[model samples]
Target: MVTYRSAGVDIDKANEFVKFIKEKVKKEFNLEEFGGFASGFPIKGYKKPILFSTTDGVGTKLKVAQAVGVHNTVGIDLVAMNVNDLITTGADPFIFLDYIATGKLDLEVMKQVMEGIIKGCREGEVILAGGETAEMPGFYPEGVYDLAGFCVGLCEEDEVITGKEIKPGDLLLGLPSSGFHSNGYSLIRKVLEMNNVSYEDYVEELGKKVWEVLLVPTRIYVKEIKKLKKNVKIKGIAHITGGGIPENLIRILPEGTKAVVYKKNIPQNPVFSWIQRLGNVEEREMFRTFNMGVGMIVILDKEEFDKARELIPESFYLGEILAGRKEVEIL
Candidate 1:
């Protein structure tokens, strides 16, 4: 008789993985959000409390982690992807759930992934409420896995940063990215393959192995943005991800205002130039496809520019808001 395990699904192994995760969660996460069919988190004491949530996957950046055999940080990327999205809406991250699917259950590999999640939760100051792990043998190749994260953030109705007030003459302040934050890996991989570059190959300009550079997990702006909210009047916040600054910044832009990002003003990260040179990709495509150097953008009135600078002294003056249609011009 055929069994589920024979068909590339392992129920017992999956159960074991769940058991392990339960122990980890109990130890590392805030127990107040623990022990519920649906994780229970209280949202009391906020005036007009609202729930902000986002679900996101790591995309092709997972492939880079697999290529490098570095599984720990992609889980952090998973959490960052969702938590960062929540903060853009001016929400304080409260809880996170993760989904893991793979061909066969590899405890060590998944442990590495979960370790990163714990670290990410700590950094973002969120709880690991609950999650699911699936062993789909036929669906995924052996040694390959994928992760998706769901996050819930709490914010007051009035404080929700919808970017509706963004207008001409506002300043575009850019926060620096550590590296490519878990996006645009499909194009990045293609360039590497076409150029015969392996993860281990050292690029002089980048000063690291190809995969080492690519697997740098996404940065979680939860704590920083939360702090900024208390001290600064954040008109809009854009967590630049898959679409880069042009596509992302435009999302928060008001109908009458546009974003002007000066190319020279951008603190260009080296990996972008390396990839552009290798792929012969145009400047526009580069900005459209990758975050380049800018990670998160904070938009505020020109009058509040110094206030923002006072808070984030190292923030770069990317460009200025302009009177135009709702789009971005990366000059």
Candidate 2:
């Protein structure tokens, strides 16, 4: 007689793995009263509070983690993808929950994954309230795992920074990215493998193993942007991800206001160039798939440019909002 364990799922091992992660997971909790049936938050003082939430996954970048046998940083990617989006609406991320599904239980791997999640949550100033981990034998391949995260944040209704305030003459400020933050991997993997390049190989420009460049953890922009929000009048915040500059930035543009991006003014990271050459990818396609060095953008009136500049020194004047169709143009 065949059993679930024989089919590559080990129920006992999966339960044991959860038991091991309880301690590590508890480290993200700050509640003094620990025995609640549901996650709790105390909201008392705000006159008008607005709640913001988002859910996201790391995309096919998990395949890169599985390829390189690096399980931890992907967990950070999982959290960063979700919480970063929550902050775009000027929300203060308050709590996060994760979902992990795998073919079998690997305690060591799960521990490292949880550690990264906890570290990411702490950095974002949010609580890791709860999560679910599932082991499905027939569903996933052995050694492969997938992760997704849900985030909730709070802000006052009047304080929400929707793009409604954006108008012509507003300055666009870009924040530099460490590298590609969990997008465009399907094409990247295809090109690299076709060229017989392995993660172990070092490219001169990257200055480390290829996998290191591929696995650069996604940047958490919540802290920096939160600081800027306090002192600057930000009209809109755009988190550059899968849709790249034009598509992503235009999401927050008000109708009749187009964002004119000066391509020359935008900085290009070497990895982007390398990928372009390797994949023979078109410039337009590259802009649509990757962050292309600028990971997040802030839009505010031209009058606030100098003040906003002081708050975010790394930002660059990418371009301006103009009275035109709701489109992004490269000048």
Candidate 3:
């Protein structure tokens, strides 16, 4: 008669891991009267408050983490992806929850992961209110884990920046990404493995190991953009992830307006070019798959372009909004 622990699902270890995380997770909070339920925020000034929420996972990047046996950074990637999406709608992320499922319980690995999560919450100015961890023996291979995050944000109803205000002649500002970000890794892994490329290999252009470039943590733009909100007239914010520029930017465009991205102005990270060449991937496919160096974009009036630039120093003036169908044009 085999028991659950014998079957590779250790309930005792899972419980012990949870007990360890409780203290570390509390470091993400400063409130003395922190409620035991979902997180709560003080809403005093906003006449009409609107809640913003988003849930996201790190995608196939998990494969990279598994390949490298590095787990902490992916946890930060999970939080950044979800909280960054929350801020796109001009929401201030206040609380975050995470879900971790693994084939077996590993306290050491879970502790490292939770540390990254706590770091992300601190950077995004959010509280890690609650989360779940599950150990399923047959669901995943040993040493493999999956992570997802849920975030809730707050904004005044009247102040939500839903692109309704985006108009023709609005300037498009592109924020630089760290690397491939959290998308297109399925193709990346396939291309690398098929070509017998190891993450340890060094590319001259990147001046580092392949996995180092691939693992560069996703940028958290919430803190920077939130500062700009005080004075800038930001019409909309787009978090460019899986769909790349054209698909992601179009989501925030108003019905009558379209976004025109100047391909020349779009910065290309060397890692992307290396991937394209390695796999003989097409240019269009490259644009569709990777962030291509522009991780987040801000749409605002042309007059505010200078101020926007001042706020985000490394950003590029990608293009502008135009009177057209709700589509995006790459000129």
Off by over 4 Å in 3: 1-4, 31-45
* CA lDDT of every candidate: 0.86, 0.86, 0.86
Please report the TM-score between candidate 1 and the true structure: 0.95
Model 3 C-alpha lDDT versus the unseen true structure: 0.86
TM-score of 2: 0.94
Model 2 stretches astray by more than 4 angstroms:
1-12, 32-37
Clashing pairs in 1: none
Prediction RMSDs, each to the true structure: 1.7, 1.9, 1.9
**Candidate ordering by TM-score (highest first):** 1, 2, 3
lDDT for 306 (candidate 1)? 81
Once fitted onto the true fold, the runs of candidate 1 whose alpha carbons sit more than 4 angstroms away are 1-7, 32-36
Could you give candidate 3's per-residue lDDT for residues 8-96 as a string of tens digits?
A: 87888877876666667655486444335555567666778898899999998988877887777888898899988999988899889
Model 2 lDDT vs. the true structure?
0.86
- Give the clash count for model 3: 0
TM-score of each: 0.95, 0.94, 0.94
Global lDDT of model 1: 0.86
lDDT for each residue of candidate 2 in 1-331, tens digit (9 for 90 to 100): 9998887778788777656556665655745533334577788668899998999999898898888789889888888999889999999998898899998878788888888888888778888887888888778888988898999999999899989989888889988888989899998998898889998999998688889999999999988888888888889999999989888998998899999988787777899999899889999999999999988899988888888888878778888999999999877
Candidate 1: residue 318 Cα off by (Å): 1.1
